[model samples]
Target: MISYVKGPLVDIFEDTVIIEAGYIGLEIHVPLSVLDRLPGIGMETILYTYFQVREDGMCLYGFLNRQDLRMFKQLISVSGIGPKGALGVLSAMTPDDLRVAIISGDAKAISRAPGIGVKTAQRVILDLKDKIDMADVLPAQFAAAEGPEISAGGVAKEAIEALVALGYSQTEANRAVGKVEVSDDMTSEDVLKASLKHLAFL
Candidate 1:
């Protein structure tokens, strides 16, 4: 039932973060996609968490947003996908992109993850496709927002496609674009450059 952890980010590893909360340090496993979103060490941040337990042990996986947490939960629920496997999927593609790939039967796209093979990707789609709606890929608030919100999403989408054409996975491109602080004046190409700089860090 521990929904989240909030504190200054004390340290960050390749796929984990340490937060100092209430005088104790909490080590949390996080996806690679969350790296760009993390604040500088000593800066406060919050991570939505899922607590997993098994006969062997217990673990905590965290995400920058609840949407990712929800997606992680959905992924782990699929047969043959464990918590680490689900995290790998999200690390490879955004939840929206994964949904699109699954719904479109694009197993090749999903199989790009580190350990997931085509068969596991197919299983994930088979088990979860019926649970997703096409419309769910878009954030609900932006679905009806007519102007700025729509424009931002379009810019990001265009940038993501451009990055994909460059051989970056959907997750990396999406996260890179997200890390860019694009003003209304910035074009998709401009965002693309900013995203490239972030990708260089990765």
Candidate 2:
């Protein structure tokens, strides 16, 4: 198990990042909460990681802090919650707010996440109530109501096209980039990082 990584951040986009360590670039998936906390590209960074192994592929989840990782682990333990689903919940609500809603039985609020339904929301509450601290999860900050725009030229466009080619809807890709606050100066590599975080939002 790869516990963590410490290296230069060669790229930063919305959802994923490429860290260069010992001449190899490691791709790591990230959520918006962690994306928001990252320093700019070409700098050094450290991330705690969770590695998921499957017959078809291998995936890496990167977290900026232990608390987020712990929350993620707790989320995925609930029945019907996969990594993607757990990420969706975290993207929409802070860990504290999620716990409070669960403990308080606010299914409506939990159901507000894009893919979650009323029954699933209630299930999440019932399953996780004992595992999380009601006092620790904070209220999540929804992105401002603005349309995302792909910059007019270069790698940003390529990145968007790549995301679309990879089966993401244009609106979804745009929203992901927007949610991550990706700047115009980045390359496609950076855009991928931004995309990973934005994907979490969806």
Candidate 3:
């Protein structure tokens, strides 16, 4: 299996990218989110990839990070969701936001995806709820130090909400908050401040 592709980005289409690796231009379908994050053409890039083979043909799906690739694999494992559907879901929500929606049983959020309906969203939640854990989805900094203090009182959640209210996207909010270190006594305001500081550097 081709685990990843690393080379100069030669082309960027609506939902695909072409990477020139070893003198070959490898075309890869990517989520809209990944497409948006790609560097300029001819710049070196790397994408973790999933190669799918079917009776009719072969396809390659790429993601900006392993978290996204892992989430895509899990999403496609559901009964009705295919590669296209999974990509649509990722395009609509970042992996961290999707994990939160699933854990919180927010079907409406999942249904916001282009091709997903409420029923499909609920199915995705029901099927993957137990499979996903916050620790697994969080960045290493958050996951490793997630003590009861940090996990309690919904400080992280509130911080993310505050960031969103400040005009940040849900994905951006979640990512920023995930990088913070919190204690039991810290209020949502404190977390938000820290997250905002992190966002400033980004």
Candidate 4:
């Protein structure tokens, strides 16, 4: 099993990244948060990873921190939760926030994740509520500002297309980008810049 990888970041899209290591580019599916933290092309990065094998193929999911990876692992253990479903949850909330929701039995917050319904949300809380250490995951600040830092550019559409190419559902891509502060001075590039950061909030 691939535990982790350290390499040069070769590409960044909405939900995946290409990291070059040992003369090969390993494509990893990631949540929006990791995408936001990604440096520009050629930057060095290291990721804690989880590998999923199936009848069709094997895929890799990665996280910026081990805590996030742990949460992803726990999420996949739930019945009816696949890698994509787990990713959906992680994409909507931080590991800490997720733990808080589960500990507090906040079904509404859990259900807010795309494709996750109230029943599944309740199940998630029921199954994992006792399994997690709340103190370990909750951030000190619960109401901090969300979204990515915006810049001046006109590449919002380009960034969205890039995200789509990386295999994110269009709805997910739109949601990630929509959180940014759009303005008349903001171009597509500006949108992309902001979107990258906003993606991290998930």
Candidate 5:
């Protein structure tokens, strides 16, 4: 029932953290990525969490952001993956990278996780590919202007987001936007209108 835990961090272990809130120390399992970002021991900490109850025990899984938590829940929804397996997957790669892999159908990348195998990795992709969108696959890529959209500014970024909202894949959006000759004074609508013309060719 706990949505999140906010308090001073009591301890940091290999795969778990103890956050003391209201005099109770709650043990939370988290990905290795979370450990790298956590503050020093006893510092104030906040983690979005998922609580699981089994016949044997109860546990909490935590993430630094809602995206990771959302990815974790999506991972566990697959047939062969559980909370721990999902944690391992998130530990292997960021949620963004995982989304890219799923979009590209790269099961090999996912199989590198601690306990996941090729078959299970493929199953993960098969199950989650439709659940995720290509728009989330490479936000950093677009923001850094590393991809076809050479500018991360208002016009190009909004055109990409709008195209994705229109149900086109991100790859399609980027290719379309990049071909349009955007002027400095162009609004997002101007770029979007020009991008739509280019989208037909893509």
Candidate 6:
């Protein structure tokens, strides 16, 4: 398997990039989200790649981060989702947001992706909910601070859910909310607003 590609970014098309490595230009299909984060042309970049082989031919799909690559793998593992469909999902939302959507059973969020219907979104949630872990999806800073308050599903959990609904990554939501000073009198909305203020400076 071709695990990764590292080279100068020679060209970037609508949904693909050409990386020149060892005198060979490798074409890699990437999600729109990856393209948004790519460096300028001629800069060296590394892409975690998945090589797909089928009866017709072969292709390469690349991601900017290992987490995105892992999410792509998980999405494709679903019965009705193919590589293209999985890429569409990644293009629509960050991997962290996708994980939150799955965990929260937010089919509408998943269905926002092109070519993904409500039924498919539900299927994605149903299939991947138990498979994903908040610790695995959240950044180390957030995961290290996880306590009974967040785990036990209270105002913190509700705040995180609201942030996720607003398109923030789970890591971003978690870290931001963790930084906020919570009180017994605070509502989920208060926590969310405080978290947003914290995230704005980050």
lDDT of 4 by residue, 1-202 (tens): 9999899999987889999989999999999878877788998999999999999999999999888898899999889889999998988987767875775567888899998999999899888977885335323231131234533323454446644644556876688677776675654534544554455446
For model 1, which pairs clash? none
TM-score of each: 0.68, 0.63, 0.73, 0.67, 0.70, 0.74
Q: Write the per-residue lDDT of candidate 2 for residues 1-202, one digit (tens) a residue.
A: 9888889999986778898878989998887777778888888999988888989998888887777788888878888888878878877876655655665567888899878999999898788766764224322211121133535244555656655655579987676655554466655545654564446435
lDDT (C-alpha) at residue 25 in model 6: 98
Candidates' C-alpha lDDT? 0.79, 0.70, 0.82, 0.75, 0.82, 0.83
Root-mean-square deviation of candidate 1 = 10.1
Ranking by lDDT: 6, 3, 5, 1, 4, 2
Ranked by TM-score from best down, the candidates are 6, 3, 5, 1, 4, 2
Q: After superposition, how far is residue 155 of candidate 2 from its true place, in Å?
A: 55
- Top candidate by lDDT: 6
Clashes by residue pair, model 5 = none
User: What does candidate 3's lDDT look like per residue over 102-201, in tens digits?
Assistant: 7656788899999899999999989997787555544444445434455534878877876675568999998888988877777665576567657755
Q: Between 1 and 4, whose lDDT is larger?
A: 1
Model 2 whole-model lDDT (C-alpha atoms): 0.70
Global Cα lDDT for candidate 1: 0.79
Candidate 5, 51-170: lDDT as tens digits: 999999999999988878988999999998999999999999988778757755678888999999999999998898778744454344443433344444766887788678666899
Model 4 vs. true fold: TM:
0.67
Residue 171 of model 1 has an lDDT of: 92
Q: Number of backbone collisions per candidate, in order?
A: 0, 18, 0, 14, 0, 0
* Cand. 5 Cα-lDDT: 0.82
Q: Who is ahead in lDDT, 3 or 6?
A: 6
